[model samples]
Target chain A: MIVKDAVCPFCGCLCDDIEVEVEEGRVVAVTNACELGTTKFMGEKRMKNPILRVGDEWKDITYDEAVKYAADMLLAAERPLLYGWSGTHGEAQCVGVHMAELIHGVIDNTSSVCHGPSILAIQEVGHPGCTLGVVKNRADLVIYWGSNPIDAHPRHLSRYTRYAEGFFLENAFRDRKVIVVDVRKTESANIADEFIKIRPGGDYAVLSALRAIVQGKADTIPRTVAGVTREQLVRVANLCKSAKFGAVYFGLGLTMTQGKYKNIRNAIELVSELSRHTKFTISAMRGHYNVYGSNEVNTWMTGYPFGIDFSRGIAFYNPGETTAVDILARKECDAALIVGSDPAAHFPRKCLEHLAEIPVVQLDPYPNATTAFCNVQIPVAVTGIDAEGTAYRMDGVPIRTRRVLSSDYLSDEEVLARMYALMQEARER
Target chain B: MKVTLAMKPAAKWFIPIEAESIVPKNFLSGTDLRVWRGNRELRLDEVFSVSVEGDADRAEDVEVVLSGDTFRLKRVGEYLDAGKITVLGGIGMHCGNFMSGGTIEIHGNADGWLGREMAGGTIVCRGDAADYCASGYRGGRKGMKGGTVEVFGRAGDFLAESLAGGTVIVHGDAGDMTGAEMRGGTLVVHGDCSRPAANMKDGSCYVYGTARGMIPTFKKIGTVQHDGRTLIRFSGDLANRGKGNLFVKGYEYLD
Candidate 1:
């Protein structure tokens, strides 16, 4: 058995350093996998059947025919849009971007909807962040604001946040103070010694109150402020001011909430403020394993994260203009090529409605909601299952994902390269 | 009417949409509306000429039935203008997100951003809503305006952050930061809450129960009862010159 360290491409808590036992061209077993990771590793998706539109009904076609058909479609499209690269690797993303540039297409990813807000905040105000390894080792005070990693990133607690025994925090959770601030009582909140439940959309007020208390302007709080009492507000603020090393792990709570960017900005500002007194940082609880990697690649390729438009062959950043939800809801793009995402099962109703109106293409290793709606569907090999590539963990740590089985299909990188070649061929033709 | 949409035997399976009044005019039947999973992006405007096609209705109220594993619908109103859309089962995130007009009632739970950055619409959830109800997308500042979201059950959190306008009523308990940096709007909570109004510049939060904590910035004026509900009034998120009122009811029960 050949054991290799790889990142678990599950949720956002991209737990790298996972050891996979490969035996006889098969993944005999995997170590350090949580419930979510186990599910992702074991979940075997069925291959999709190739289909070409003859008149109204789509007929199954060969893989060669499908690839040729997809290439032809991209070459023929006047204004093509390529989207969805959250689950793949940076190399694949690079290839996809080049394909978009070759075709002059609008290339986007799932972050346009998921963490696009966080990326925007990073651009506006530099993100005060560190790797999860640093957090696992140095952080003594861990605050989960509006995010429950237990349900989302199942192994986050045991692997990185609380239980993981690091160099500095030898006692791990015993030496740490866990504070969970949320609206309802979550599984994580239940275990937290200090659980502050603010009313929904009340984070901004709570953060400000904490900031005020940290600044020591006021002592006693009013009887009511954003549903939280003055006393409890002080407790949370004091936690931030007094902690030697603190980290705030926020999720869709800060971004998608009422404040949106303002909420994130405030949270980031709060962390910045706390850092003045102590060492504190904030990290967005990204969803997909490579979401942050996607952001990095997107930023690297176009100097923008998500919601980028390349109509002028130059990247333009506009959340309201180019974000997947906004772009689709407004009916902006003329054609779209989706890779490894299920927008039909993931996007908002408005965006999905607009998507139903366009010419769509899908490429993936399995059957999904977005592929079911494509004008052309191309089946590709699973990245970590049937193909090998490099992917970044949520913490920005690069880890190689190894293929565990054999497959005749191409990788996402290969597919994008083929598309790029086809686009070039089409341009020449 | 029972509309059963299964995965067509194609390489990719998109959503099978069958509406009562609206139908696509001139596109391939299974090829028009498409869906995919894994790492792919689909542009909304380029797939089909008409996204949704349904028979125009005059019943003053119409219920569109959607059945699938997880369906994400965007620009739902462009296809058919109806009084109400009731989702019987679990829906993907942003069920009625960015809806300009109409009422959407989700019978089952929705993922996240139930009515994200909605300009106008009413979304009522009988089940639990995941995260950021009637709020903005990940980074955009503007949130729901001219809309109402009433969650009968529990909510995830960030109930109404950066809300410009509208009313969100969570009948059950709320999560954290009920009204974070709210500019204008109203959040009504009926159960015990932690903090109802956080950094709210302007807005009214009426908590029918006692709050666990309150920011020191707000000044409690007194208590008032309106429409058979006792409300504890508070003013000033003072940090941002906010005159927003945070009202906590059932103060007597809160030792």
Candidate 2:
């Protein structure tokens, strides 16, 4: 049986035109999906049973026992930190927020590590953002700053930025001017019309120079700012100013480097400033498939998007403080309820030590590093594969993840709901 | 009177307590304050053991000491006009956000957004600080308008970003962007930095240690003497016609 027009829940693109062929409850092939999406849809590897760590020994436990243990641990802890909803569905995240509120714990998502500064910058300067379709249709000038869409978002250039035929742009690649700006020459830079190599950590400077040049203050700019010559700056500025519509897609390179939020803020301000001459929009190239969903759900439920703390029985947002890294590094939380994120693999050494010290209960479809380090692990059905839920694209467009195959395992939302019910019962008692 | 708020172990929750209402200036000996835990309001006494000692008639004369992990307390001394507030343990985010005048000392580590958009104050963090220290609030153009933020230990990324005025000094290593897009201010980093003063329009950055790279926008001028130390001075965030100056102490020019 072939599932037509299925959403690929692997990256922020959230490509919904995928066709998955299922053979007896297993994904046999995935068409119209990138390699990464194919791997995700094909069920590369998955955990089938619930596991519990007893005295440093891994023991296979029933789902009921795992859920009970997870609930008890969360309810008993004075301070509990619930992290990671990026890989799951919005339904699961909503339940996770409720659970965090009910348990009076901190709930943070993957945005804290990646695109966090971009979110902060968006909140500061305001995002002149648009959907991928707009970029595909109207954007004549597409710039990729500190992002490599070729390796990260495989079909981004072909589907949205460069090659896709649109209403206004019939010869997409031929008509649009593709500019790639990065510290080093990346794969995407090789194919761009202009590749501007910038010094690492000089994004803010380069962006400021661009802003200056675009605003007709080119004479004041240095001969070479961030390794781009005066002529290059003038040309690029003129191109941006003259373009009917332009779009900039940024990635982790800007957020992870020095000047993190300021870099993104400068980029946003540049896009905003360019509005005087032309139409331009900026978007962060989100990594995780549903990470955008995580931020959106958290923002709607809690005023703040990420790093929400409910320790005092009120929702409080302060990124660095309530963030998972800081919370774990401080060893303030006694227990943790992690969902669909591997902190053990990604967190700093000090944070991982603290995470190991605490009792962690994880809900994931796979047995990854976090599950390995966790005390209780409950297996869940993968969304867009064996489970169905709503997911948000990078541009805040909601798409329903269709389950192509039926699984005996429970979904993340179901598991979380069960845990919430058990915790409520414990509290009532 | 010196006010002390000691946390009780049983008073743990995920929803952070907004304790800005419990500023020293607003508190009397027997006065009570209400803090929010999520949407619910709780008496300050219910969460912390509050006690007042020592006499004070003015906000500046009052000293407030908060003792606990305080990792869940948001905006502890927000908009503090005047007073001295100290955190005994690790503090949550926005410890001294938008404070016009005050002294906030954290004996332990502090989370992000410390002294955000502070107009005037002195913030001292004994331990490490998370990201966005001494930065503007979301959508705010200026950051740390006037204040002195001294971090004894390391600081996370985006330190003193979009700084408009005042001074920020880090005794230990800083993560990245020591002073990014700074319009006017003085940022001093004693330890190594990834990058300092990117897109700064008008300001001064002093790095006592190493910086990974210098933006081409800044022109290298001759050395200058400051506090008995010879430093390499560079002017211009020239990208935006900036006249910012960056001084790297103990930096030797490689031929």
Overall lDDT per candidate, in order of appearance = 0.69, 0.85
> Candidate 2 chain B, which ten residues in sequence have the lowest lDDT sum?
B246-255
List candidate 1 segments past 4 Å from native.
A22-28, A53-58, A219-221, B1-255
Task: Report the lDDT tens digits of candidate 2 across residue range B1-255.
Answer: 789999766544544566778667877545588876544577889888988887877898988899975777878889888889989998877889888887999999998889889989899999999888998766567888998999999998779988999999999998766787789989999888866787788888999887765554566788999888788898857655679889986432110
**What is the C-alpha lDDT profile of model 2 across A1-429, one tens digit per residue?**
999999998999999999999998889999999999999998657877998998879899999899999998888776788999999999999999999989888899999989888988888769999999999999999999999998999989888988888789878879999999998999999999999988776677788778877767777566777677889989999999999999999999898886677789889888988987889999999988999999999989987789998877778676666789977876767889999787888899988887887789999888888876699888899999989999999999999999999989899999999999998888788
What does candidate 2 score in Cα RMSD to the true structure? 4.7
lDDT against true structure, model 1 = 0.69
What is the lDDT for A26 in model 1? 58
lDDT of 1 at B218: 70
Candidate 2's docking class is acceptable
- Candidate 1 local Cα displacement, residue B225, angstroms: 27
Residue B140 in candidate 1, Cα distance off native in Å: 13
lDDT of 1 by residue, A17-83 (tens): 5777766655667788787776676666556556666657878888667777777766655556688
The clash tally of candidate 2 reads 16
For candidate 1, the TM-score is 0.65
iRMSD of all candidate structures: 9.1, 5.8
